[model samples]
Target: MSLYQFGKNLVLVLFKPIYRMEVHGRENFPKSGSVLLCSNHIDNLDPPIVGACTPRMVHFMAKEELFTIPVLGKILLKVGAFPVKRGLSDREALRKGLKVLKDGEVLGLFPEGTRSKDGQLGKGLAGAGFFALRSDALIVPCAVVGPYKPFKKVRIYFGKPLDASEYRERKVTADEMTIVIMEQIRELLEKHR
Candidate 1:
């Protein structure tokens, strides 16, 4: 197995018993081609939880600060995470995200930009929408419910893929697409609640 897959499997094995994790709607994932797994962020563990739930290898756009640490940065790189400056435009990160999509890989993004301290859904940043528009990749809305506490049952629901083909020919604002993705995420959260 690839290093990424091996690491993912190892983590999943450890997380399964402690988290009581459950994954639903994984069948919605596309069999092939580029896909953007846009999800709601509740905690630091959200990325690994989502990654373990899905079978496909997901490349995440983590904050650039995480890449500065020595050992953690090396591990993140090995797991297919690229750096993104949290507050600024970070054109370089956007280009890298687009390249991952164009290469027909699955890219994971937390549209809310940062973890919700109160576990409440927040407005999505424009970055996720911008990537969708630029790459014309399918936006798979995912909702990760419950806290990341040990022994607690954390559920991950992957909603249907949102197509961006309609906006391919027109000039649509990122805010518009962000709203749509957030709404879908909210719906999924409510469904499981």
Candidate 2:
């Protein structure tokens, strides 16, 4: 098995018992093609928690700073993560994201760009919206609900996939597309939480 899968499996084994983790709508995931697993961030563990529950191997856009770290950088790359410069228009990062989708891979993104201190979804950056508007990838809205308290139930609800074709035909702006994505994420959170 791939290291990503092994790592995901290992995490599920450990987390399920401790966190009582439950995943909903995992079957909503497409079996093939490029897809963007978009979600809201509440905690530092959101990425891994969502990734571990995901059936497909998800490539994340981690901050460029993390890639500067010693061995952690290599490990992140080996696990299918790429770097993104936060708070600036990094065209290189955008190109990389577009290329990943064009290559028919799963790209995971937390559109808020960072963890929410209040567990409330924030405004998604143009970067994420740009990716959605530019790619033909399926936009799968997901929500991570509940706390990380030990033995507490932590649920990840993967909502329906928002096909970008219609949105693309309308030629919507990146910010508009991100708003739609966030709306879906909010719906999932409301329904599941």
Candidate 3:
């Protein structure tokens, strides 16, 4: 296994008994190809939590500031994370993500942009939609439910793959396209709730 995979596995094993995590619809994950595991972010641990449960190596677009720290940032970088500026559209970040997807790697994104301040799943940003539509990739909408606590039950609900072939052929505005994609992700989570 790769060092990053080893680290993730080590962390997951240590946290398993404490977190009492549960996962559903893991079978929905594609064995290979460009995939967007779009999810809701409710806690700081959400990314790692999702990563640990997933069988494939997934890259996440973390905040650039988070990498400013010395040791922690170094570790994050080694573990398949790249920086993305918040509050504005970073074309470079999107390009990096797109390239990763095009290489048949899994890209994890929180559709809400940042963590939900109210601890609830919020509306998704246009980026997720834009990436999915642009790449013609398969999107797996996931939900991270319940807060983290020792022995606390944390559930991950993975929705079925959302195919965007129809959108590829249409003459839709970027804004309209983004909304439609975000709405699809919202609907999946809402249906589970």
Candidate 4:
């Protein structure tokens, strides 16, 4: 099996049942081509939990600091993660992200840019909107509803793809897309929370 598959399966076995994960709306996932999963961030486990539940491998642009941690860094690469320097206009990371979509792969992003301390869906960074505008990939709004207590039911909701093509064609500002993306995520949270 591929490293991404192995890691995803491991998380399914280790994180899914342990957290009592309940996934909904997975039928919205695309069978092929590029997809960008914009989700809310609550805990460090959010990425793996969301990734494991999906039918496709999710390549997340993780914070650069994590990649400096020796073994963990290697493991991330094996599982198809790349590093991003947070709070900076890291063009290299953007390039890698766009490339991931161009290659017909799935890329996961947390629009808020950081984990929410109170588990609330926060405002999306404009950078996320920029990335979405740059690609022809499907933009799917997803939410990880959680208090994350052990054996507690942690719900995950995947919504249908937003009309990214409209935004792209109109040449709307990055802020515009950011607002729409966050709104979709917020709606999912309100429904599931």
lDDT of 1 by residue, 155-175 (tens): 999999999878666778888
Clashing pairs in 4: none
Per-candidate Cα lDDT values, in order, are 0.91, 0.88, 0.82, 0.90
Cα deviation of 166 in candidate 1 (Å)? 1.6
lDDT of 3 by residue, 37-69 (tens): 888888998888889888788899899998999
TM-scores, all models, native as reference:
0.97, 0.96, 0.92, 0.97
Winner on TM-score (2 vs 4): 4
- Clashes counted in candidate 2 amount to 0
Give the TM-score (vs. native) of candidate 2.
Answer: 0.96
RMSD of each: 1.0, 1.0, 1.7, 0.9
Judge candidate 2 at residue 25 and give its lDDT: 96
Which residue runs of candidate 1 sit more than 4 Å off their true CA positions?
A: none
TM-score ranking, best first: 4, 1, 2, 3
Identify the superior model by TM-score, candidate 3 or candidate 4.
4
> In model 2, which range of ten residues has the least summed lDDT?
125-134
Candidate 4 per-residue C-alpha lDDT over 1-193 given as tens digits, one digit per residue, 9 for 90 to 100: 9888888888888877788889999999898999989999999998888998888989999999999999999999889899999998899999999999999999999989999988877788987788789988888889998889999989999999876899998989999989989999999999889
Pairwise lDDT winner, candidates 1 and 3? 1
Clashing pairs in 3: none
